[model samples]
Structure formats: structure tokens, C-alpha cells
Target chain A: MLVLKPMMQKTSAKYFFLMPGVLWILAFTLFPLVYSLYLSFTDFRLGKEPQFVGTKNYVEILGLDGEGGDDKALETATFSLFLTLGSTSMTLIMGTLIAWVFNHDLPMLRQMRAIITMPLFAAPIALGFLGVVIFNETNGPLNNILQGLGFERIQWIIDPWGARFAVLITDTWQWTPFVFIVVLAAMQSIPEDLYESARLDTRSNWILFRRITFPLIAPALGTVALLRLVETIKILDIPISLTGGGPGAATQTYSYYVYQIGLRGSFQLGDASALSYLVVIIAIIISSIYFWRVRARFD
Target chain B: MDAASSLSSSIQTTHSKPGYLPGTSRIGRYLLIGLAFFFTFLAISPFLFALTTSFKTQTDSIDGTVIPFIQYQPTLINWEQEFGLGGTETFKSLRNSALIALGSTLIATILGTLAGYGLGRFKYGIGNRNLVSWFMSQRFLPPIASVIPFVLLFRDLKLIDTLPGMVIINATFTLPFAVLIMRDFFADFPQELIEAALVDGAGHFQTFRDIALPLATPALVASVIICFSFAWNEYLFASVLATKEWKPYPMLVAGSDSVRGIMFGFVTTRMLIAVTVPVFLSLLVQRYIVRGLTFGAVKG
Candidate 1:
């Protein structure tokens, strides 16, 4: 039954299947990545030749060159960090609660879960457009509901803190379902007999969660948290749509800042490339930690 | 949750409920139910508001009238303006979006599946594990980092604002997701079938095509869904590359704001159109959502 193909023929088949993907990645990702790295070191613009400046762009973006450097980058970077922490924590806590609440068997839950998860797929830019109306100080449903509840109306889009809150809540609403779904899957994977045995030892729900549920689901939570953190750090679309970095740049995120410098304003391609590399560095650091932890668990 | 409580109460009034702990008071149960409903409302409220706003007139939209007939008269002017005869830009954008998304998804899925199958079934000089990790790292590369180079490159090739160009870049970023997920799927596939086919004198490609490909349909479909959505929702590259006649619908939605502030009626219509495309296709991917979202990390 051993109808053996030649070794040379087998190797040809492998390359025939694999070479297209490799070529595509080379043409699109690796070449452009290297090109952008070169761009980051030059003084490039839309209509001019790129002259290599050798770390000047990085120096200016890092605010080490005080003359031409902008402090706004630092400010936006801080805001981005705050937004990442704030929104990621909120998404995690809310996701844990919702997933825990819905972990049990229920009627129509399958359908409800589909509905709840819809926002995960919605376009963030579109959500931002809707946010303008939803968070409208006057004649918006959110403020109207708050007034009905005997709370003061907020200047959601106009005030600085309110604009920040608008971005935060919008992001949380969009991503919490991700955590919910992953955590729910994790929780459901715990053996039923394990929980049954634990119930025999404890009459308190909190104790059962602390002893059985939390430890079992902790890894899943950590993975989701880190994933959400990375995504949040790169946020650009919602701020573009919802606030447009308005109310005195209160909601300008780091990605938005990079876009402003590179594409929108002076078309500073060099600085933009440098800024982009900075983000890449941060992302690489975080993802490295994620890989180390997650790969260890999987192995 | 309510169902769990009822099952517990009906059983022996004991502490043996599998999911629910021994003691959840009636108020606690009610609170959980309340929280669930409230969150469910919060989850869909934006879409709900967009739906109503799509049907509202400019004045009535900002007037805070939510109900259709009682509070305000619903109108089709917004929808008509967008989907009707005067909506040439909208029509073109929708067509461009569909073409780009479909074109990229087709290319990425085919290429990714082949590479994934090769990686899964064969040994290579660079180990399959390292190759998979390389692809995964590509998935994490920030689009901003590449946008400038892409802009310059596309301009030089005269590929800017063209459907093929958009397809190339989108397929680039989305290709990683397809590769990673398909690799995971193929890795976990049962291998006895391949050996049987080989023993029957079928060549490797024949086995992969006739036997393995059919069995890998679910993974293929999942990869297709994910790649399609990522391309469809792509905005950054589209924003820079497609300047003129080839602009996608997301650009239209993001640029819907008029000089006189946001025309709520018009913006809402575009917003709904942009969102409905992916959300509608999402139902087909319900089972694959967790795995797809996490890039097949935590398999559902």
C-alpha cells in the first residue's frame, strides 16, 4: 500500500501551497514595515524628497528637542494611558458581572446573548456619530433619562471631563461583550461536579466564587484584560467621530495625536513614522508579556 | 439566572445547585434580573436610537421624541435620500465597500488556507511553530506604522484610490487572522483521514482537496467571516488610500457630518448602514465569535 511519492515532488507540493502566503506577506507587511522604519529617520513629506535626519524626528517627538518639540504629545499620551486603564478596567468588571449573571441555564439567553454581543461588531466611527446624539446636553435620550431620574443634566460633549467620559463609556459599551463571551466560556468549562462539591462546603455565594470561580477563570480574565488594553491604546476611530478631539483636546488619544501630526496637519510623515514606532514598541512590549504568560499556560 | 433559581427552589431547597450557590435571596435574584435587563438595554440602545433617528426628520430627531407615531411622525426622507436616486455617492461607496471586502476576503482566505494547511500537515526548515508565531506578530503590527509608507508606495504605483490597492493592504492585515485561525483549526484536525487517502494512492493535493478541504469547511467559513468583517470595517487605510472615486462606505459614514454641524437624520442613516453590514453577517459566526475575536487563542 506504500505508493511513495519522490521527496523532491513532496517538497514542490509544499512550496506550491506555502509560497503565495509568504510572498503576499513579504510584499505587503515586511517591505512596508521596513520602508516605514526608514521613513521614521528621514525628513519626508508629501511633495518632497526624503532626506535622512538621523534621530531628529524621534528626538522631536520624544520632546527632547524643546525648540520644535510639542508638549501636546506627552499630554495626549497620558490621556491615552488613562483611557486605556479606565476603559479596560470598566470592561473587565462589567464583563465579569454580566458573564457571571448569565452563566446559568436560562430561557432565551442564547438569543439575548447574540443581541448583547452586537456592539462588538459595530463600527467604532459609526458609534461615535451616534454618541454625539446620545450624549447631547439637550434633547438627547441619555440626559433626558438622567433628568427623569432626578439627576442634573451633564454637558457631555462640551465639557472636558464629560467628553472623556463619553469616549470611555462608548468604548466600554463596545468591548465589554468580548470579555463577557470569553469569561462565560471559561466559567462554563469548569466541571459541574467541582462546583457541586464546593457548594457542599459553603452556603455563601461570595465564598463559592472566591474559592472556585475566581481562580479557575483568572487566566481568561488576564488574557482578555491585556488584549483590551492593547486595543484601547490604539483607539482612533471613536475619538475622530464622537468628539473630534474637541473641548480643547480633552479626548485626543495617542493615536489621534499621531494622525494629526502625520496625516492631517503638516503632513509630517517623518514624525508620524517616529510616533508610530513608539506605539509599535509599546505594543511589542505588552504582547511579549502576553505571549510569555499565555504560551506557558497552553503548553 | 431566574431559571437557575427556580430550578434550585424546585429541587430540594438544598445547596446543591450546580451554578448557583446555596443562598441567593429573592431580592438578590431580582437585582440580577434587573441588572441583566438594564445591561441588555444599554447594549442595544445605540442601535435602537439610530433606528429611530433614521426615521425621524431633522427637527424631530433632536427634539427627543422617541416613539414613532405618538411622539413624532416617522418619515422616510433620510432613508430615501440615502438609498434613493439622489444617493449616487452613497451607492458608489456601498458598491466599493462590497467589492473591496469581498475581493480581499477571497484572496486572504484562499492563500491563508493553503499556507495554513501546509503549515499544519508538513514539516519545514523554519519550524511550523515559529512560522505561526511570525504570522501572529504581523497581526499585532499597528496600521499607523505602515500607513505612511503605504501611502507613498500606493501613490507611486498609481494604485491609490483603487479597489485592488485597498484589497491588497486590507488582505495584508487581515491575512494574519486567517492564517492564525486556520492554522489552529488545521492543527487540531484529525489526521487518520489523510493517511487513509494517501494509502488509497491519492496524491497529497488530491487528499487535501477532496478529503481535508471538505472536512475543514467550518474553519474555512469562520476565517472567511472574520476576514470579511475586518476588511469591511477598515477605515484608516481606506481614509488615506481611497481619496476619490473609490471611497468605501465607512469613509462616507465618518465624513457624514455637514458644515452645519452633524445632520442627525443623514448621519444616522449612514451609521446604520455601516453597522448593519457586519452585524447581519455576525450571526453566521456566532459559534466562532470567541475563537475568532481572540485570534483562536482561547478556543471556544
Candidate 2:
């Protein structure tokens, strides 16, 4: 009975320490999430009661302009899906390359690395807008320099492909540092004894990488790529601030579309909320795969 | 945009191996070096032009040619104007930035430190990892997706255009990062010492306040720097939140960004003010930051 009493007391005290966080998340994170789902089915404006109109609101949005809502959902879904894939692949590839490049031993590499990663700190809007400043048609340095070098200036931020490339380039430059940091950390954590053992057999670096480093660091890379995937998809600041969904909606990503509908003009609260849920579901599916892989790796 | 410069050197170390493959020959090395220079220039050129333009006479910025590093006459007026040393909106933005940065840092640091200590040291074995993972997920979740919902939420709460609103969101976003970092630092501590303190009649809070907090000073500083930089450069929430009187500095930088169109003098001058907070903080805590970031990433 004494043991039981003390054990109960200890357990109660432990729960005390944890309650704040659990409550904070439940009220803020979980509550909002549930509310978002509930509100998705209704025709609720910001100030409205979030009327329970069943799946009608969802159907209406999915069938905007009498075009059958499923088709709209399918169409936007394709574009977002493609957008997600493009950005994620770019972030992963460029990030890994940046990590590799920065891993070198040059006298200037240290300082150079700081500069290379500086773009990550610059506001996304700043970087994207800077893209226009440098890549714009008039007096931007890239154009001026190209023209001076006897080459023609490419429309870097004006054309659809050009704007897409601009976004790809900017996102890759900013986020690659993130991957570089995580991968390098994982690379460093691999036990040196394994590499030393490989070297006794005169194993080449590539062989060492394939057999030892890749597997060892694979977990961190997976986590990083997953994190980047989620971040890249909903990213809006750069697209909004830089492109503003302009040039005939060519560069408008999903989040920007959400903002345009939700906040910029008339409030399509139901449609916007539904769109966000769709976003969450897509993110969950993509990240769930990575999540399972991560668990498997740990297991 | 929360890239910590302290991290740049660590990755470079792993890539500097002397022994290489058959392909790492003279041509390859040169090619790699050339690419490095190419990117290095590509990265810094905008800033260089911005700097030069800031010094150019406002007229020269747009009209002048960017020669080989020495085309324009230099002046300090733009810097003065930017830092509010010239007494313009630059002063207001600079002041606004520092106030928000300091305020947000103070709040986030205090809350995160307490939360970190709680989550780190006194695990009751009930909801630790689940809570931890939940916190970690917030870091990756796109702020954009959350922003619309939060805008509705914040407006309802009357938090829009207010310092507290921005601070709340900033702290909320930075919490997972802080907890993650502080937990790593706490996990590195000797479990035996904590146990010993418990044996000596130190209550949970007492043991943490006396022992863990003091020992975790390095991690605390790193957490503060990270939180501060995050709050400083945060744009979306601030742009949405700060309506008129309560504008944070980054919003001003975003605004100033468009005003200069190849006009070097004004743009670089404004950028200097925007860039100083991060660069200054990074250089100040370079040593602790590298250790902190590496520890947080690689350890539990």
C-alpha cells in the first residue's frame, strides 16, 4: 500500500509537468484542426455560424461554374501534385549538391559557405523580388551583363517557363542549405571506425559512401526531405510577394490561389477551407509515406 | 529564411577529404573551383550592387554603370537614412525591428526555456514523444497553409496588426525548434547528477532551476539567437499582422525592396539595415551556434 501510494503521487506529479503542453496543443492545434474540418462542410464566412450545409458547399466548389466540382478538384490537384513534385525534387537535389559542394576543404570555402547559405536567411519575398530586380527586362544586371557579353537577355520572370524556373531556382537556393545542414550532420555522425575499417581494405570513397555513409545518413536525409516537401508545397510568401499570381496566373501555386480566393477579394470561406483540407490531405499522404519510411528506418 | 550561418563551416569540413577518385583530377578540380567561384559571385553580386548603389548618388544608382567594383562616387547618406541616422522612415522601421526582435526574443526565450526544461528533464513517461513529435511537425508545416486560418483566428482574437500577435505566432513557430534544441542539450547532461540532486531533497523545480538551467546556459543562448533571427526576418505573418503603427522591420525591407529599380544607392542602403540584424547576431555567437546547431541535429 505504501509503494502504491508513493507511485501514485510520483505519477500525478509527472502529469503536472506535461499538462500545459498537452493542453496548449489540444486547444490550439487539435481544436483548430477539427474546427477547420467542421467548417469545411459549411457555408461559413468569417463572421457566419458555419451553417451545416452538408457536402453541398464542397460540391459547389468542386463544381464551380457548373463544371462539376470533381473536375475542378482533379484539375487543381494535378497542378498542385506536379508543383509539389517539382519543388520537392529540386530542393532535395540542390540541397544534396550544396551539401557536397560545401563539404570541400578550400581556404575560401568557409567564408564562401556563409555567403552561399545567406540566401536562406533573406526573406523569400526579398529573394524572389531580387530575382526580378536582377532578372527583369530593364537595367537588371543579368540582362545588362548578357547583352554586354554579346548575348540576348532572357525573360527570366516574365514568361511562364521563365517564372517557373525563377521559382525553382530561388527555392532551391534558399532551401538547399537546410538539406546541407541535416545531411552533413548525419554524415558526421556515422561511426569513424566503420570508415577506418573500410580504408584498411583500401575502399574507395565512393564504395565507402555506398556501403557505409549512405545507409547511415539515410534517416536524416529522409526527415529533411519530408520536412522540405511539406514546407515547399504550402509556401506562399515568395510566390505571392514576387509573382502575386500574375502574368495570367502562370506562377500561381495552390496557396496563392487560396489567398486570392480567401483574403484578397470576396470571401469564399467554404471553398477556401475545403481547399486547405485538400492541401492537408495531400500533405498527409506524401508525408505519411516518408513518415512510414522514417519509422521503418528507426525500427 | 531561418538559415543560420554558423552552420556553413561544418558541412564544408566533411567535403574536404584529400584522397579522391579517378575523376577528381586537375581538370575536375579546376572545374569545381570555377563553379564555386561562379556561384559565389552569383550569390554575392546582388548584395555588392546593392552596397554600391546605396553609396551612389540617388541619381547615379539608376544611371551609372556597374564597373569592375569602382564606378560610382560613394556617400554615407543612404546608410544614414537607412539606420535612421538620417531621421526618416528608416529610423521608424529600424526601431520597430529592434523592438519586435527584442520583445519576441524575450518572450520566446522565457517560454521556450521553461518548456524546454519541463519537456527535457522531467519526463513522467506519459506523453513525451507524442508531444515532441507534434511540436516538431509544426516546424515543417507550411506557415502559408496555417496563415489563412490563423488570420481568421487572429482577427477574431483582435491580434491582427499588433506586436503581441506577431510575437505569439513567432514564439509558437519557434517553440518546437527551442524544445528540440533544449531537449538535446538536456539529454547530453549526466543523468546521475539530476538523480543525485533528487536524492538530496531538491524538488523538481528546484533541481531544474539550480542545476539544469545554469548548466544549460549555452543552449539557452543558442536558442535565443535562433528565436531572435526568426522573429527578425519573419515576413508573412508580420506583413499580415502589422497594419500601420505596429509594422515590424522585415515588412519595411519588403516595401523598400520594390522602391529601388536598379537604383543601387537606395536599395543597398535599405538592405544594410535589414541585413545587419542577422549578420551581426551570427558573427556574435558563431562558436556557440555551430556547436548548438550540430548538437541539436545529430543528437537525440
Write the residue-wise lDDT of candidate 1 on A1-299 in tens digits: 23355566679888888789999988888898899989999998878889999999888877677775668888898889989999999999999999888776544556667778889888888889889878888878899999999999999999999999999999999999999989887787777788788767877778877888999999889888878988898888998899999888899998898888888868989888988999899988887867766553221
Q: Per-residue alpha-carbon lDDT of model 2 for B229-275, expressed as tens digits?
A: 77777777776667577787667666755565444556556555576
RMSD of each: 5.1, 4.7
Candidate 2 lDDT, A1-299, residue by residue in tens: 95586466556655565555556556556666676777678887756667887777666666754866654445445545566677777767766665555444445765665565555556666565555555666666777888889998878767877776666666776676556656654565555567676878854757867787678767777666666677777766666555555566766777777666666677767667777777777677765665455332111
Q: lDDT of model 2 at residue B131?
A: 54
State every prediction's TM-score relative to the real structure: 0.93, 0.84
- Taking the candidates one at a time, how many backbone clashes does each contain? 0, 8
Q: Which stretches of model 1 miss by more than 4 angstroms?
A: A1-8, A65-69, A295-299, B1-31
Query: Which predicted model would earn the best DockQ?
Result: 1
Error of 2 at B184 (Å): 1.6
Off by over 4 Å in 2: A1-13, A46-49, A64-66, A70-83, A108-110, A148-151, A190-216, A287-299, B1-42, B62-69, B80-88, B122-127, B257-265, B283-300
Give the range where candidate 1 chain A is weakest over 10 consecutive residues by summed lDDT.
A290-299
